[model samples]
Target: MTVLHALAATLSRAGRLARAAASGPDWWRGAALYAAVLALNFVGVWVSIRLIAWNKAFFDALGALDGQTALRQVGVFFLLVSASAGSWLAADWLRKRLLILWRGQLTAQALDLWLGGWAYWQLRPGFGAVPVENPDQRVAEDCRKFVEGLLEFTLDLISGAVALVSFVALLWSLSTFALPACFAGQVTLGGLMQLASAFSQVTTALSWFIFFNRDPAGFVAVCERLDGLMAAARAPAPLPGAPQAILRTASPDGALHLQGLRLATPDGRWLPALPDCTIRPGARVWNSGASGEGKTTLLAAIGGIWLSGEGRIAVPEARFLTLPAGAPVFAEGLAAAACYPEDPATQGSAKLNAVLTRLGLGHRLDTADEAALSGLSMGERQRLGLARAALLRPDWLVMDEATSALDPAFEADLMTWLSAELP
Candidate 1:
């Protein structure tokens, strides 16, 4: 039962992604590309059928010892081969291009949701009530694989259907021919053909039933990954007044206010409750506590991320940015990473370089290669996180142990720079 449910869910998600790609804004172009591929596939099938006929003619000529006819049939063989190869290659090229195009659309949508709100954070294994595993794989690898599989399977199905119809018709026509008297004592050739066809179809059906009942490993893995991606895309959005224990409202004044605030884990275990208080605009308050003391949870509550809480938290209506303990660094260039969540092109390179320089990440700006970026130390990553905050210059900045990796002196220096630079 669970397996069936998972399969159903996988199909539902796959169908939605496929439909979205097909009906997206560039639907006409996608439709055209698909039609071209399908037409090419049909042409290839026709060439194959023609080659089958050519084989009969060539063999007949060879049996007759007709040199001229045999040579002519060989020439026809080359023509059919050329047509088949050309159509197959063309169709293959178009199919690949279509695969990439659809993958792009699917990846873009997945990314939009993954990065839109607290989804990236909340979908972590232990972060939310319902966690999605290997979200990165879902966005990067699974999207590509899913689209590739969909196309490959669809084309294979079409080819099989066309071949089945053509071959069945040919067989039916040939069944009219009488066999030798010794072979056909009573049963007609048509009856024999019908029986063979029926047996073949029943065997094929049974084989497929057994194949599905056993649950192929590769397909099950794909379905599981698709299910994860679907969950990631549906992760809760970071918005005020979400359906959670907390009731968030917009502050009329430019201040952060908490009233009757209480916190709890997703499992319903209560945490230290925050006393009713207000942090007015321009207040540089810091939350400090030992590890596992709910300081980070408090920050999450203030940021509208931790939903398992009851409170009337009022936040100012402004651009908000949160810097977690380990800020994310993208494979995109240093400049882009520094000004993340915002287009790097919109920000001047000089400003980006200066921010990184201020944060002591200037030396690392030369390389945007992912491998090089991966080697960044914890301190350097925190500095980059600060650089993002600096570049974005949000009206409200929430740091949850964001500078924990840096030495005291450097952290203090960065803090001073932030205070001087931001309001």
Candidate 2:
């Protein structure tokens, strides 16, 4: 009864482990490969059992063998060699293929989540407990390691269970069903010896459980460390409030609203960057501060590039033009420069020159064009950014120190033009 109970428990646990391994998404992704590998692995195990049986038969036959029959063992030796080679090759090939596929799926999932809809940007500002380490390394290097480790773990667990089952069955067959008793220098037997064997097996199993439980504990520790590393790598944004805005054309009257704005750093546990400030529509918002007082950060928050902390930002959907501290220039001709952020093919030359000429950049349209936009001067790039805004005719134009590069004459002309253009 004791032996029976131990076998029943071991079989039950092994079945559960196998079911879990086979049911995961990782299995489905490379189901064919897993099936092949599992089949080969089990076949090898079966062959190994057969080889042991044959070895036993050989030993038993060796005592009664004649010279002619003795040579037949050589055939068994060759069979063992071939079976070993084929089984190993099959198992190894499938292991590598499944691992590669698993890594690929993990990497692809990470890439999609990272690039889709500003997820990377949000991570920088600290959103969830999800790790955002060297995103390049995490997505590229660590993903592969994670997948490979998981694959090895799964395979080892499955194979271990199979090994246990094989060994237990062998033990059952090898053991004699006879009770042993020594009393007064004599021995006596009861019913079958299975109950005594079962008790011994149960004791052995209990000993192994106490010793092996440490492995799972170590695995949990490693998982916790991974989570910690990811948390440490996160870069939380310094700005608060979700920027929800619409293109200018969508709203009859361009309006920008800020409500309950807050901000914090990745490491910060309490204080928010902004203490809940709201800016009404058409307000001449001035974000003045010393260098690095989060002026640029605030502008980025308003531009809908960063979403961290708390609060809400509401704006009529409209075309939004944001000019960073440095402007951006296009390498295309003057027409392309003016129609930047929009294709030049959509706008006529007359409209392009008109906006450029108004911004003191009319002379640039006739210059020799080049493929590299970096060839232009910084001031020239700044003017191009303004020209792009003019051509787009966005209802909301945000200039973040854009005029700092322009001369007084052009700056006044540009601001005057901007004021007039805004209804």
Candidate 3:
């Protein structure tokens, strides 16, 4: 029951996971390998059937004490055993390989759904209708479990069905049935038919219990989480009565405009409303307040990623960049992280190398850190975020306490660099 519970939960996500993977051509290529694996597994099952016959012959020779026959049977037994073993081993290897590929595809699908179209952003507090907890597990661990579980159950079912069919045929061929004369007189059905019907009723009831009432609590838990994430990913462009013009393309002249726009919490409660403020192009304006003053919320609303806000905001598109409080770093190496939100390849190696050097990431340039960029301190993450802004050369840059982590001197140096470097 424990195993069934675990399997049902994981397999619940398999259909959606496979659909996500099948969206691309690479996963389809994996399907061909899947067919090959099935063929190999069936061939192994056939070998087992042959081995069962060899078992009878070998035992008969031994029972007769026939030395010549026993020796020949020994040779035959070895051949059958070797064939079955080889077939099983080969099929096992193929199944494992298939598992790896299938799991990889499923994982990639989950990532794309979570990351693409700002889905990750909306799942944050005050942005989504559904609360998604431990999305990390859903995207990583659950996907692994789902792929492995589905393959295990699917293959076992296939092999068991094949073996059952073979055994039933053998039994039918070798068996003879008889009944008491009185019983035969009372029932028109033959003894074999009566036996078959009785066995069928028992097996059918057992199978029904196994199939329809199988525990699915584990799968249900995952399904609810994934469904929430899916809802977040499919979240509509704007909430009810959201002014379309306000969410339109940013002002062309690099001006930031706010007209009666009020920032709200996730549940549509007003946090702090902007009293119609405007920042002229190239003007230096500062927004400051005590803690919980909705500073970050304001920044998000202006950036257009926050749908919890109401009213109007006009900001730039590509020329606008936001340096949020926390640096968003990916696992792709240092160069990629520095040029994030923009392809690293577009910035030549020499240019990226120079930016890292100028931003005091020269040591990182050598390390070429290809991991998650997790080892970096708060200050280091801030530096990388700033470096990205400089590289992008955005006409409009919004910093929400982006420089708070760095020392005053370093912060001054960064502001000075940006002033000198950006137009």
Candidate 4:
């Protein structure tokens, strides 16, 4: 089978490569490797033919009595050497060109597949996706190695097979064919040589198999390593589904509906947000439970961060905004950064200015400097965070102590802004 065919078959059989471990050498993959063996055999036979030719010439020169003629023959040999060297160089150059093109194509395809989706992040920590060790290395180094190895292996097998065939033919012709002796009876050099060569070839073949079968073993070992990494990329299964587990239904206008959302980690498990509760859209719901009540964890579960233990969080078909403790201010322009997740261009300056003014930061519209925002007191940061939320106008905004820094007056003002926009 071709290298492409074997790879396809292996991938198909592996299903979700992340879930199952790869086991044993797939014989189908061995076919292309065997082709490489054939290529190597061809190289061996071709080299052997050159050796035989050199031997013939050396012996003929030794038998010549005239040193002058031998000298002439040596000169001719130099020309022959140069011609052969040039041919070998050209052949090698062609081989490398072909190899590069083949490898480039495979590399591009593998990279595209790997980079697709949140595949990279999914394969990272705490996400339950299988942990691919040294993901960068796998995507960069191993991919290159796989392509090179597959190509070399396949071509070598092809060349080896051709060499084996060619050598057998040449050897048969040279050793076979009946020839009549000048003064004696006819001799069948062909039959004698054929028999001897057959024995020799069989012995050589057996020895080669014993020594070279290690190649396939090594190849499979590499494949297994790659499979191990692939498996590590799959997300761990959701702790066996809860009895009668059901997902909450979301609303049409993108409001978040939280109805008795109760969740607890499984045995021997640790997670935040173990609080059970219900929250309605635009309700200004306050989670007044004490610390460690999993208030933040509750928020996370609702926002779709941790999916391990949960009841149901119905998120309407609208943009959902979850602001953790501190607002993440980027180094970009304050206006642009405030309306993150939505482009400043989309919201426009007028809308941005309105939100900024409402949050009491109207004077810094064109400030462009980040120092102004960063130097703000604690209360100012909360106002900016609120302004950011207002600018985006997300369908659902889940705030975890976002207004903590603001005093009663400012906090009341922030609450008023949120309540006014609730409908």
Q: Each model's TM-score, in the order given?
A: 0.75, 0.51, 0.72, 0.50
* Candidate 2 lDDT, 224-286, residue by residue in tens: 333333334333333344333222122234555555666444443333356545444556676
Best by TM-score: 1
Per-residue lDDT tens digits for candidate 3, residues 1-423, read 998986665566556655764456676666766677677767765665555555555555666676897799778768877877787787788778877787787677667778876777877654555566677888777666666666666666666566566655544543433345445564222334434543453354346336743235654565556645665666633444433333544666667778777777665556765688778867778899888869887887676667676687877544778887777887787778788778988988888878778888868766656643758888888888888988888877889888889889988988998788788
Task: Evaluate residue 229 in candidate 3 and report its C-alpha lDDT on the 0 to 100 scale.
Answer: 63
Q: State residue 366's C-alpha deviation in candidate 4, in Å.
A: 12
Rank by TM-score, highest first. 1, 3, 2, 4
Candidates sorted on lDDT, descending = 1, 3, 2, 4
Superpose all Cα atoms of candidate 4 onto the true structure and report the RMSD in Å to 1 decimal: 9.6
* Highest lDDT model number: 1
Model 1 clash pairs? none
Error of 3 at 379 (Å): 5.2
- For all candidates in order, the CA lDDT equals 0.74, 0.59, 0.68, 0.56
- Candidate 3: worst-modelled 10 consecutive residues by lDDT: 186-195
Could you tell me the C-alpha RMSD of candidate 2 in Å? 11.2
Error of 2 at 214 (Å): 12
> Each prediction's Cα RMSD?
5.9, 11.2, 7.2, 9.6
Kindly indicate the candidate among 1 and 4 with the higher TM-score. Answer: 1
Error of 3 at 160 (Å): 0.9
After superposition, the stretches of candidate 1 with alpha carbons farther than 4 Å from their true spots are: 1-14, 20-23, 55-69, 129-131, 175-217, 232-243, 325-337, 342-390, 402-417
Clashes of each: 0, 16, 3, 27
